[model samples]
Target: MSGDAVQIPDDRAFINFKNECNSEEGWNSNCNKSGITIWIQILRRGESIA
Candidate 1:
């Protein structure tokens, strides 16, 4: 799996993730608190790897 960090503008932000899935499933999560936000992504493939 691969990910990146981005800057949000105007006290709010919209983010999108695009990728290809090959015999694997992807997961994502986001958190927001106290004017701070974090995003995460995880990819799993069979018991092998991302």
Candidate 2:
């Protein structure tokens, strides 16, 4: 997501609803594969979102 802001999506379902899409390339577990969930944070100038 190389833009002003990228939607990290509510889940992997939105970006990949394709039934035949692969696991890493797509959400093959119906968004149920739990792990380290990384999220995007939006910050203004001089803001810390880490």
Cα RMSD of all models vs. native, in order, equals 13.0, 13.5
Q: Any residue pairs clashing in model 1, and if so which?
A: none
lDDT of 2 by residue, 14-44 (tens): 6565533333432223333357444334457
TM-scores, each model vs. reference: 0.29, 0.20
What TM-score does prediction 2 earn?
0.20
For model 1, the stretches where C-alpha displacement exceeds 4 angstroms are 1-29, 46-50
Give model 1 RMSD, 1 decimal: 13.0
Predicted candidate 2, C-alpha RMSD: 13.5
Clashing pairs in 2: none
Range of the 10 consecutive residues with the lowest summed lDDT in candidate 2: 24-33
Question: Which residue segments of model 2 deviate by more than 4 Å?
Answer: 1-38
